[model samples]
Target: MDPFFLYVYRKLKRKCTKELPSCSLCVRLGKTCDYDGAASEMNVDQQVLLDRIRELERQLEAGSGGGTIAEISAFPRQGSSLVNPTYTIHRQGFASNLYFLDPESFGPAGVPATELDPGMPVPEQVRFILGNRAEVETVTESYYDTIDRWFPIVSRKRLVARLTTFEPKTDASVALLLLCMKLVTQILPHDENPRTGLYWICHQFLMQVEGAPLLSLTLLQATALMAIYEIGHGIWPAAILTVGNAVRLGHIMGLHDRDNAHQLFRANSTLTGREEERRTWWGVVVLDRIVTMGTYDGSILTADVRNHELLPCTDSDWDSGNIAPFGHAFASDLTGIQIGHWAQVCQAAHALGCVQRHRVDEGHAKNSRLDEAQQLDRTLVSLAASLLADMKQRGDMAINDPKQTGSRSSVDAIALCCSARFLLYELYACNDGKSNISRVSSFPSGQEAVMQRISLQGINECVNIMHQIALRLLEPQQHSTRQSPESYITYHAGSIFVTHALYWAASECSWIVKEGINAAAARVMGDLVKALHLLNDRWHRAGDYIKLLEREETLSD
Candidate 1:
């Protein structure tokens, strides 16, 4: 056959085998034909290459199985020191230099430890665990720069001093430092797994310190940080457990008893140290209540008189290198950014917790749930008036002031004030569709009826203020600007409660909408969607809510 004819014949034969209708030659001459086999051989060659690559990977894994941790640490980026000796890891090869990991770190369960003096610092004892210095420092700096502002659990000066100057490694401090780093990685962009190996290590360390002979102030703070970590990661059950443990630990350390704290101050402790102890206890209490807000349950801290101490003094006073004046009374004259807002939040929590306790009461108490709710409402009203008064006092100068813009804490305080009021309304008005109190039309008889009217009105005001704050928070300056995850989460914490109220208003309290109320259900829902969309990037929960609203829309359609 001619060369061109032969090539054409082969191409036609291949096409005929792949497609259906027989080739012209086969149809005309009634012939059976064979196709070229080169494609089959090529596929075989590719498969062989892939198999070889996988085999080599398996072999490499097998070869590394026998290497000691110290030898493995010798490999580039294979090791991380414990960073604190008191938090001893029972494993080796944890501190890899990688910034992003795919699946899992070789945790304590899987790895063998390198022999070292048990009393040595973790950084000196373990060779290859944790992470590199630069990565660790980045996470540490990111945390202090962001989350620490709201919580103020760690003192900046003290943390800086610890990082700069060498100090004896303590389990509690190291656990807290590790948690701060973990939180930063979670909030910032590292794109690692949600539960990182670093988190597991910190968790392990915290577990080890659970029953130590003496639980220090630092230890209680560390426990609280762990709860924040769990909250940020969406681990509610674990967060609740951690918060409960922290509260108990605080009591064990005598943090709740002012007398015990005073004794500590008498025994060579600085006034600042005692204040920090006080602040940590309050931080634990506030978080305990905040995390479990909508469940209508009281916090573990309880409404006991002893549990309520003076709110923490100014952050400046707590962070001071020298002893500063400590006032147990609520300081009304302090700036919004000062410890005053923190006090307001704490007191508001106390009041709300009181209401929840009353609601859950079994009628064994002298006062009815309605009576106690009214009283706590009064208490919260007083506190909110103080916060608003402070704002009013600073209103003229504060309008264009950077403090209003930059003070996330103040924004949070105002939002909490609204939430406290909103929650009190819910306590009386939320019927759960099965109660005698019809939230829709009728109110309780007489005094209860009057209070319900006031609470309903209060709900309107609270929702309106909440809407304005949400708008301000979701404004271009706040949302568009790059920020840490903590900022968005903290902001959303306040707004989520508002969203809950709007949900109730739109569904059950449609009469509020019918009456042309200040916080119209439809209007607030629209604003909430816009605000949540803006926050969708930093907080996934906002996006989740948006999806929920959309789904509800779809279902209605």
Candidate 2:
């Protein structure tokens, strides 16, 4: 056995296991395999050939030196076991033969010549393929903020524009608007005043659209209803003022063009059905009433006095009082609850005024209005308690109602329920010695017991109603093949209302539970947030669909 051969054999076996053959020139050239046959076969200078051969020999000697041939035989050449171990091929019509080693001579099948180096898990060669962390973060944050800020404004604008014009409704603009409103309401706290600019813009658009004058009724009523909410909590006096001005404008327009107004109203009334029309008509009347109460001093009192006479109720009705009519008509499901709640609030206000007058007459106070105002505050607390109970009962029924359409009416119902809940909180605060009146809790020791006896389970029930409504609205509706534009608009608007109700429920959860009762408020809030995100995503997809449709139309044109 030759020592040099043994060393070479050992080196070959080691290379088969854990290394790959390296050519210095090829390595320097940054190429994988060397052109060994090309160098050998090419006609070149003898010196160059000898130099290459010497270099190869020198590398071999360095790799394997001073080992015996017997030891080499023991060293295991990679291809020693095979019967036909080598293959020969002729080079270019010449009898020169080339020998090749079999790939299996190396290691097990599919094993690489060398293992990956653990020190550098991510190699410098492929490091650049990974993205920049900071850039990714920056882009993500910017993308989210852009969506958060711009989407609401854009959606609202589109909604106002669509509603202003009678477009063949597809579930695009209205759905987008509802989703935006829902998100905004959910993320923003209740006490944080909502921007009136959007509402004002919508109102202005509705006013300008020339058609059936009553076409604006829904929008107007929605605005006024929101205003009532703000006024109830003593937030956004400007909104109250704006609503008052708008009502005045509506009155002026309706009065001067009586025939046209009457004709349009009649037509709209006929279209929407007697109940909805009456609800809307009374909504206008209520808006007017609210404006009068908010703006003109003694106007609310006088109006109440007149309404009391014009639409008189039996004493039993007021006292049987399990739940007061609150207003004249309690037929239609839409406005019945609303009218009831508003009337109760107004009645409470009137009672407070009376109490103030009585105090002044007894010479107990110089500012008689102040005393009456205090009493009114107490009445508000009581009224809120009663309404809370009624709402709870109604909400429970709504949840259990087998025939509930889960439509826009349902959304409105949830909205009213939430509104009632908030009013209860406000009234509770007012009666807690925080605002207008002396603390009802401190009045008589028994008063606390009486007030505490007021059922708050209704708040929980209302929360549940809101939760269910939110779920229903967020659910996609199966559209009819020939659904009307108005129906589409109505559906979208209802979705928005549903989303808003959920948002309200979520936002109010902490406050709702702060009174020491764990209700569905928190769960409802979570559900609403999830539903809103879903609805927003859907709206964006719908918008893209509309764009595609428009593009197709343009191409057709």
Candidate 3:
């Protein structure tokens, strides 16, 4: 978008001409005109769009009287009250954000704080929140600052605004959304935290809300948040189940299909809604693919969505609600395209899906599998190079810019690259005696040696990156008594997002150490073991990695 027009629309309180070759202002100023930004409707009257949406929604609710949700399919049918709830699109600027409010710190570790009654009535839950408004605001703020910073699925500004109103009580979906955020952000060190008591409360509420006839955007967002919480806390089949719920909901809502969303909205929806759906879908994709990595388990994601979806806007554009239209970017349109950190992560997740679903497994020729694997290897190499280079250039991972979505830790997006590389090479890691693709010990030939060399390079880079992260996370000569793994993730206590990537790298490292003696690989493994040990108390996946690494260490002995 034109900076002048954005300022004029946002600050000067004027309508935007939205001219293509520069607005009249730019033409008069004799500036090179460009209007490369968010939806054309953005600079227009947002209230008008909201009013239209509200009217359409009212019509929808009126058409469908009332019904109960069945089989988790909340789609509306003829004469059914199961409508899609559209919360007021968050276009009210930074007032949507509560940064100006006095943020009282509300960590879960403390007692003698405002607490919620577990048996509070469904509608009465909002009262608990209103009574403890400061605490609610603090935890929501913490979510944006830590967990949401790197893997932002929902808008903190929108949630903050929703919390201040009656929406939570009126909308069961909104209530579930708030519960999921509080569950994730507040319940740390799960054993002793009083908020852990709310886990079952939240889960039960989710079960009831999931069956609601009205499938609100807030419901989908809630499921996604709950999935993140379960995944991060290493909650077993619950994590898998929650991820499936979110992914299936995203698919049912046609979030993966840009044209489908357009059809549903029918010309009145703005980029704000599209961007929200985009981020929510990508968040589910990241979770879905990451969970299924290195496992035979199939992905809940349906047909490849590369050609059908638009990647999220840049971090700054997304935060300020300056999101461009779908024409700005499509997944297929972005090859080696440097857009934003999360966009790159989306691309990486796509690569992972490609690796898992590669043609190698089909009853094709060995040469076909080999050729496709090489292509995948090149894709990952290019991807890892782009992400690592940008991360190195960008410098700090603390995210000093206030315009930034949230303060992210170092492992925000880069770890997925390592994971993709390791996964791509895992099938080829078998002995050359058994397979022609791998030539680690046996004599090398033309194409096989070249592929082997590339595979080893990718493998080594995984260790190199993991070693760098472990070193960055663990200070030199610092007292190593780490009862808290969250603090060990970054220089400070940043939320953990990529422990699965760490586990994958450790598996590859263990294979390396078990197969032969690589001094550098072994040293990296040591750093990883120390880091994993700290993380074990928090994430079950990390603890598993520690055991796997130790078993490899024993074999090396």
Best by TM-score: 3
**lDDT of each residue in 1-557, candidate 1, tens digit only:** 32223433554564334223456754443233336533433453454454445545545775655444221111111121132132223333232211014112432222121221122233322122324556556656766555665666666566565566533243335534555455433542323344544555556555544432223566677777777666544455777788888877766444566553212112224566656666777788777666676566544463343533567776455545453565555433333443454565666666656655655665554335456667767776666666656655644114233224443345456655566666667655644445433432333467666677778777766655556655655554454554653455543334332343333333332445455554556666566556655554454444555565666562131
Model 3 segments more than 4 A misplaced: 1-131, 190-196, 260-268, 325-328, 331-338, 397-406, 432-449, 476-497, 514-516, 536-538, 551-557
Per-candidate RMSD, Å: 15.3, 31.9, 21.1
- Give the better candidate number (1 or 3) by lDDT: 3
Which stretch of 10 consecutive residues in model 1 shows the poorest summed lDDT? Answer: 71-80
lDDT of 1: 0.51
Superposition TM-score, candidate 1 onto the true structure: 0.65
Local error of candidate 1 at 538, Å?
Answer: 3.3
In model 3, what are the clashing residue pairs, if there are any?
Answer: 1-36, 1-37, 38-323, 38-324
Q: What are the lDDT scores of the predictions, listed in order?
A: 0.51, 0.35, 0.57
Indicate whether candidate 2 or candidate 3 has the larger TM-score. Answer: 3
lDDT per residue for candidate 3 within 1-557, as digits (tens), equals 32223333454353347687568864443233435644444332453444445556655675553343111212222222212223212122222122114212322121120111111124343335323567657766766665666676786556656666834345456666766777766534435532244565567567655543334567778888777677766677788888888877765445666453311122225667667767887888888877776455354454555565567777777767677665345543355455766777777777777876772355555566678889888777877766666665556432222121124433546677777777766556554566533433333355566667777777778777766665555542254465554553422332344566666666666777776867566677677767665555445556655666566564254
- Encode model 2's per-residue lDDT on 1-557: one tens digit a residue: 22224433554452111125865544542233433333334343443444455545545775554332111101112222111111111122111011013322322222121111111111111112112444323433432233212111122222334445522222222222232232223222223434433333333323322111222333333444444334332345554564565455344224212233322122322212332333333344443433332121223212223332212122223223222333353221222234333233333333433432332243443243334434444544455445445545545224343223322132433354354343333333345565533433345444433333342444455566567655554444333443432233233323322333454455455555455456655565555555555444323222222233335442121
Worst 10 residues of 2 by lDDT: 116-125
Clashes of each: 14, 10, 4
Instruction: Tell me how candidate 2 scores on lDDT.
Output: 0.35
